[model samples]
Target: MTPETGKTSIPIPERTRPPRAARRGAIAIRFRPGPAAIAAAALVCLLIGLLYLALQIRTIFSDQLKQEYAGLVLEAVERAESARNQVGIWQQLPDATEARAAGYRHARTELAHRLASLAALVNASPSAAPRLSPASFTADADLRDTDAVLGTVSAWWRAQRDADSADVRLRIAHVARTLIASAALLFCMLITALGMYAKRNRLLAGQSHEFEWAALHDAMTGLPNRRKLFATLEAAATKLSARSASCKIAVLYIDLDGFKQVNDSLGHRVGDEFLIAVSKRFRESVRKVDVVARIGGDEFAVLVREFSTNAELGEIARRLIACVVQTDLTMGVGMVSASIGIASFPDSVDDYHRLVAAADEAMYRVKRNGKNSYAFADRAN
Candidate 1:
């Protein structure tokens, strides 16, 4: 070695930051959280769960208030009967008959005021029970017809306010207990998740991504939801906005024909299975670049990112119509057809929203003209 180098320093490699994955892997092996830490976490979770249960009691309390108000209505009906009996006694009185008559009139007025309060309550919270207009109740509740008033009050209580408060309280208590237990389990899971996270955060991240995708995509057919469709449409719109003259996007709105009749005849389970099978056929028939989405009940939308001409779109539409007719479904979900409408950007409309509306209107026209066919918005009269 040279004398100058030997005096200056010993040879050493350059230092750099550790890789995130390696550091994360070391975390699990380096330290373990104690039982005390876990217990504290569990307590925090339990408190949060109790807070949720407390909020649910607001709804339970509202139901209890309804029962109390309904009981007041029954008492008013009893007061009406008492007033009628007082009227009879007043007529028989030889002395101080005028004072007794006044008392009867006071009772009648009190009953009317009570019913007015009850009618307001019923209106504030609408009930399926027969309409209880205060004027109608007062008209029918003549002093001579005491029994009718009593009968109506009893019937109202049975229908509108029959839900017992005790039942609501009991159910709430059961749910609270279940949630508390779930909180404990969640705490235990949290620690386990932490341990796994220490080993590999990427794995945990992947699981979270899957849950988010499920929310964005349909559960039944694994297609994009309406929200996803809107996002995709907006993205496409933005890209085409710059090159309005050259670029184009197509939105195909498809509604199944005679689906409701078959769904009603077979049952919802069969209908669901039928839709799943139909979705598979749609995925297979469409271009790989296109986005197929299940937007609503028996309604599917396809977004064509790019297309050459009207003939190209027409060919794709014909294939989709034929796919539905040719595909067979399990669970006895018989022959079904679709009515498809097509609208293109820059070709049909200037606005993106107007483009969607145009497609929807054209689909309805096909439904009216004849079923099991495709119609272009530009061609539709």
Candidate 2:
């Protein structure tokens, strides 16, 4: 094919080094190369888990601070009532009314201040619970005994405050325990994210590599085409020349006989199967070192390397003829066959044109001699 077809010529990128901006964009895009559905689900789950943990902690601390503030308020009310009782007891004594009244006034003022503080604490509990502490308590005879009915009944108020304080402490401990559990879960989620990222990156890399290979390779048959064949031969010839190896490379030109007849007689549908069968046999006939290509309609070529004598080329050509003849076309034909032509490198020519021309000339000789035969060209003749 000529360069005008735009198949053989590859365009070089404007910048050998990709632009910095492009590199950054590619990294950003590649970073999220994970499956969209799976990534979205994982992200949603992570957010929900974190929110659940936060709400649990909030509920625990909120209840704790509320109970603590309520206890403080109850304690202040109990102290106020206790002071009023003392005032009444002092009033019963002669000449102590004024002194007891002043003490009662002071106690009332302190109690008012404590009540204000408790109001502020409860009001701020929603926001400040994370930092608030439980209330401090004092013990007395009335608070210690419940059997003293009058004594216990008077102290029942303080008992309520103590119970509230206990509730507050219990909630705080529950919050702390839950926070520890949440931290462990967060660590596990982070580990899972890391492993998933690595696995996704590897998968994307492999897919990218496979995509590149598929771009240049034929889908029907694994063999290269004429364009790839030419490129490979050029590279191989350079390497072989440098080594100065006593090697002769030969090209086997193959044309499938009665291929068109099979297509015409048994529909193109069955013909496709026949072609696939032919491609398989071609692959089996060549050695690992050989490069094979489907150059045209019903025509294939094989580049055999490191042959020391004409006898080796003749033997290979004979094997190829036998391989095609032995293959069952399944189209109810007598026998399938291919005429092969052998052309050697260096001895044939120094340039690509001369080498290909020699091979083509040999192929025509096979056709002229009779079908299902082989021929080799001699440059000296």
Candidate 3:
């Protein structure tokens, strides 16, 4: 199939392949991808959890404080009414001046005690303690009105006591309502902050995962590139290096024999198609344990970690060659062939670089000696 790159061509297997450079270049470009992108989603999730917890704490405090404030205000109003009634009866008796004065003294003391208790309750809330003040209750306009009404009744000791008592109760109720309103506002603000933080965290995490996937994959061929290949190889080598089993690493360098003619004859479009076809063939022919990579122009390498004999190696090479040679091309070119070079580790060379070099040398030998042959660098004893 024709690809978007317009660099290679797909032809029937019968046609000779195009230039190796075009095929390799196209494959490399197809698979290369950008670096890993940072995921902010995880961070976002963490922040959301924290913010939610904080909001919950705030809400609990607001609810508790509001309830407590309402109770205290009601208790204060009841105490004021009781004290006013006791003093009023003494004043009406006229002969009980000393008793009335003593009750008034006791009544003022009770009011002070109740106010202190309310202040203590407000301070007990961990979240609200820093924000609340004794002055908030005492300075409240409704509370002030209640205090004024109580003072007037105590000073006059007349028929105005019932009217003043009603005013004090209404004022206390108003103060409690104001406290609840303030608490509701605080709750809304906390929840809003939590929502904003959660949204930010999700965005960050999604980006991070997106970038990670991009890093491990090839952008074009959707295959693992050299970077991923080397990582796996390094890990495998470390595992095998510790063992002395008859384990062997086989490195194969494959080059398309007559690929240049395809590019020269049909055009670059057909050449790219031929390269994609070659990649597909390699995938189909290689064993499950083998990894193939397109390192550069028309050149592919395979790392095979298992194989007991040269015959086994030859079988794999023949399969690869056959896979490519047998492909049908529609570009009207003749049959194409591949030259494969094989090298083994611990048998031909000790180092990875030398091993690859040996395989490369063997591949050139195949090209020089004959186009469609597999060559080996290892000497037979």
Root-mean-square deviation of every model: 33.1, 16.2, 18.0
Ranking by TM-score: 2, 3, 1
Question: After superposition, which runs of candidate 2 have C-alpha atoms over 4 Å from their true positions?
Answer: 1-38, 41-224, 231-235, 238-244, 265-274, 328-336, 352-358, 368-371, 377-381
Residue 226's lDDT in candidate 1: 86
**Model 3: per-residue Cα lDDT over 212-286, one tens digit each:** 656865554445566666666676666678877688777788888777877787777776777677777787777
Write one digit per residue (lDDT tens) for candidate 1, span 1-381. 765645657789888878999888799657655445666666677777777667767667777777777676666556655655655665566777677768666656666665565556555553354546455346336554445645775686765566656666776887778786876588676776677556566776888899889988999899999888878888888987877567789988898887897779877887887788888988898888788999899998888988879788788788777767765344445557889999998788667877677888889989999878988897333
lDDT at 52 for candidate 2? 69
lDDT of 2 by residue, 233-269 (tens): 7777777788775866778888877778777876777
TM-score of every candidate: 0.47, 0.55, 0.50
Rank candidates by lDDT, best first: 1, 2, 3
Ten consecutive residues with minimal summed lDDT in candidate 2?
132-141
User: lDDT values of the candidates?
Assistant: 0.74, 0.65, 0.64
Which stretch of 10 consecutive residues in model 3 shows the poorest summed lDDT? Answer: 33-42
The candidate maximizing TM-score is 2
**Cα TM-score of candidate 2:** 0.55
Clashes of each: 0, 0, 40
